[model samples]
Target: MTTYDFSNQTAIVTGGAQGIGGAITALLASQGARVAIWDMDAALAQETAERVGGGALAVQVDISDWDSVQAAIAKTVEVCGGVEILVNSAGIAGLNAPLADYPVDEFRKIVDINLNGTFLVNKAVVPVMTAKGYGRIVNIASVAGKEGNPNASAYSASKAAVIGLTKSLGKELAGQDISVNCVTPAAARTRIFDQMQQEHIDYMLSKIPRGRFLELDESAAMIAWLVSSENSFTTGATFDLSGGRATY
Candidate 1:
């Protein structure tokens, strides 16, 4: 466990109420950042924030909706000071089905939340961080994005777009002190599994050469440094957390 300094910083973690997002929020708060947990479930977000207990704030946010995102930013800034770090962990796995069999509405919904949502949140926060001339961002993507999954077309495509967005944004802000990057992680045993079919889950597990799923703390630790001041040279990059599954 490597300790990183986040003293006097403010972090916004979307989907921060549960699963990977919750882990990120807790770790950030523990390291001295005033964290804002943004989720669609207002009650769960508040509960998670309260549990973090360092003046952590919670705001109901629909990352896919422009208005909702704007409102969350306003609330976060007012309550948590300023947004210097943003971890876009808010996303969904759509459904497990072949492309032809995938539900049209579900596909759209997944893209809306997983891809458009990431874009919306980052778009809203970039300027705030740029004004300060310092910021750190970590967008949570997936290994499926790199190596598209058979029955998970929507999730793969959406995350692949996230990787592209991170690259473009990172380059756009290359001159600035702020850094933008994303992590492509293998499946982790999180509440997200509830949205997936057991067969699909098994398929994902089989792809991991490490013979196991990723741990929440491991994801949190990697992200902590990526969003820290210590990570000065890397931006517009993709960090692999696929447990020997990523070839590139």
Candidate 2:
């Protein structure tokens, strides 16, 4: 396992209570970074923080709400000093249904959490990174953003927006040492799967030529490097973790 020194650095992993976010929190903490787990599930986030140890903290946040995001950043900075790294892994895969059949409220809800949430969190953290002139940020996007999936319009559109947002933010902060990037990963077996249909899951698998789902550790390995000082040169880039499913 390749290791990067994150000693004395503080990282914020939104949705860090479980799934891909949880894996990232564990990896960052293990490498000496004081990780802050931000999730909607306060209890699970606290459990994760305790398990990771090393000054890990759990901050409950509804990323969709600006006030909640504001509170989370304030609390995190108060406790962890300042955020040097951020991994926005909090997102959802809403119910799969044809565009015509998709409920209006459901679509709005999906966009609220996946798209607007990313915006609010990034907006809140950019100043902190800019103040210090150094930071690493990685927003979690989905392969569906690149290649639209049938019956998953809301998720695809929102993630596509995340990619665009990452690009714009990366360029905006290019003058500084901060690097902003995103990852478009294929499906992983996590709690988010509960919200998806079995057919949709199978369809996703069929599209991946690798015939396997992405692993949590694999994601952590890539993200660890992205958030490290070593990733200085790259910004406004999309790292693909789609298991051969991504053409570009």
Model 1 error, position 235 (Å): 0.1
In model 1, what is the error at residue 231, expressed in angstroms?
0.6
lDDT of 2: 0.96
- Which digits, one per residue and each the tens of the lDDT, describe model 2 over residues 105-224? 999999999999999999999999999999999999999999999999999999999999999999999999999999999999999999998999999999999999999999989999
- The candidate maximizing lDDT is 2
Model 1 weakest 10-residue run by lDDT: 74-83
Q: Which candidate is the best by TM-score?
A: 2
Residue 42 lDDT in candidate 2: 97
**Tens digit of lDDT per residue, candidate 1, span 101-181?**
999999999999999999999999998999999999999999999999998999999999999999999999989989999
Q: In candidate 2, where is summed lDDT lowest over 10 consecutive residues?
A: 1-10
TM-scores for the candidates: 0.99, 0.99
Cα deviation at 20, candidate 1, in Å, is 1.0
For model 2, what is the error of residue 210's alpha carbon versus the real structure, in angstroms, after optimal superposition? Answer: 0.5
Off by over 4 Å in 1: none
